[model samples]
Target: MEAKKNPRVDIYRLKNVFFNFGLMISISVVFAVFQYKTYENATVLDLGSLNKTTNEIIEIPPTTQPPPPPPKIQLPKIIEVANEELILEDLDLKLDIEMNEDTKIEQVTFEEDLETEPPEEEADKIFMIVEQDAAPVGGIKAFYAYVGDQLTDNYPTAAARMNIEGVVYIQFVVEKDGSITQVQAVKGIGGGCDELAIEVVKNSPKWNPAKQRGRAVRSRKVIPIRFILRQK
Candidate 1:
């Protein structure tokens, strides 16, 4: 017995069957895949509709710096004065019982301006207006009389007895009213002769008054008195 003949191979039917299976698998895979469209079933938010449609590319403005603030007002500078040392007050001194009770301390201030003037001269007038007083010629005479009366009895035994001739110079002031006030011996001779001479003039009468500027004024005068004792 011969080996059973192998079943007849249907190559065309096998090819047809494989082709149909591939086609069905491709269709099934395509259907199984998810399909999405961005425009499908879009939800529309309601906004107010306008008659015109516009698209604008707006240019943003650049930021600008504001002008610098006005320069700060400059006030004039004030200068401060320097401190000065305090001056102490002088003590109030009172030697007597009389003094002020309410004396207050005071500030010492000095002025910068002062002027000096020239001295004045008055040839006819004295330094101050002082009137002349009458000289005491009467008193001088009384003094002389007293001396003369005393000397008349005592001259012989006096210590001034001399033989030489001598002159005595005396200065006297004659007041404006024809009176003598002061008398002095400007020159004298040794011994009591000078005293005797002065005694004589002091006892003399009042003199005529001198005049200055045509007006009777007191004046100074010098007189010489002589005293001689004879030699025995």
Candidate 2:
């Protein structure tokens, strides 16, 4: 016979009261653990060690060196020399040189010009009269004498006019009738002198015919016609 409980204080009311009481105990315990952890982790900060870091050194392999250059080439020298043995020695040899010397005189025959000549033996040996009568002097003198007067007269006037001084050698052939057949100047002294010499010979009179043995013959003669312009 307990005292009579209030009707309002039932099982439902007891359950609510117990649940609220447990919740309050659990919250208080969590708040205490957080405050203990924060207090244990607290420390002082060092500003000098804030920017510091560690440095490491690494080594690499070394490179190789290059080789040296090659040497230069040299040329040989040339020298000139003359051979003396070939120049001084003689190669050819000869024998048998006969020399004859006379000490004594034997005989000397002097022939004179025989006048009234002997009778010719051969027909070709005869001196024809016509050739003998034509140009008695058959040499170069005869040619000059025959043309001298003509040259002297004709060339003086021309030579004085031209003032040429030289000797012109004229070669001409005399005909059997004692006249100059052809005349040519072998040497000239220019300035109209050579032409004057030819003119002189061409104007010459008939000459004495030359004779070979007994026959008349034509002969060649060389005459030197001089043209000298006198200096006043």
Candidate 3:
């Protein structure tokens, strides 16, 4: 019989495996002991004192602060206006008041339009008709001569060119002060003669004013201004 082959000859090569398995078993045993073992040194806390109540009852008082006041708005101090009855209401006070002296102000009076009244001298200033009619500064012939000479530049060329021959009647207010004013055409001969006649009369010099009861007065004067053209 050959020497009995050592069947466990390779067991030495697996010795590291056995060693690792032994290390795992030791770790497992330590974990099992730590998980199952009880310690006598644990401190026990009693919660019975938390449930116990004293005889005193706590009471919370209601809030004592008042609500805040409304915000204030800043406005202009003085406001001026035309004469009118203005009612002012004071928001801070409960009453409506008028502006016065004790609240400190002066008196005010109303006035009328000054232009409506005229002076005494100008009261009988204008009259449409008087006792004596107003005359030009010169006699009738001299007045026509002056009119023709003054109207040399403002001649009715349109009427002359068209051979318009007719008389233009003009009306005017000869003022009390001998001034010729308010000259207007009564009956017009067209073709520019109407406006020309009126314009010529408007530029006439002062006249001898009309007389009413021995006093110089305004008078309505009507005159026939001729616009005769010569045939060429």
What tens-digit string does per-residue lDDT give for candidate 2 at 37-155? 43466577766656667777768779787776666667677777876665636757567656568545568987887686755444323233343444434655765676665655566
Instruction: TM-score for candidate 2, please give it.
Output: 0.36
TM-score of each: 0.33, 0.36, 0.44
RMSD of each: 43.1, 32.7, 26.6
Q: Name the runs in model 1 displaced over 4 angstroms.
A: 1-160
What's the residue-level lDDT of 68 in candidate 2?
67
Q: Comparing candidate 1 with candidate 3, which one achieves the higher lDDT?
A: 3
Error of 2 at 70 (Å): 97
Taking the tens digit of each residue's C-alpha lDDT, what string does model 1 give over 1-232? 8866445664565788899999999988887774533557878888877789788989999999999999999999999989999875896867676448686668898865467433433433321122443333456466446545655544433444444456678887765566665678889865676666666556666765554434556667676655545445
The Cα RMSD of model 2 versus the native structure comes to 32.7
C-alpha lDDT values of all predictions: 0.61, 0.68, 0.79
- Can you write out model 3's per-residue Cα lDDT over 13-46, one digit (the tens) per residue? 7889999999999999999988996759978886
Query: Which residue pairs in candidate 3 collide?
Result: none
Whole-model lDDT for model 2 versus the true structure?
A: 0.68
Sort by TM-score, best first: what order?
A: 3, 2, 1
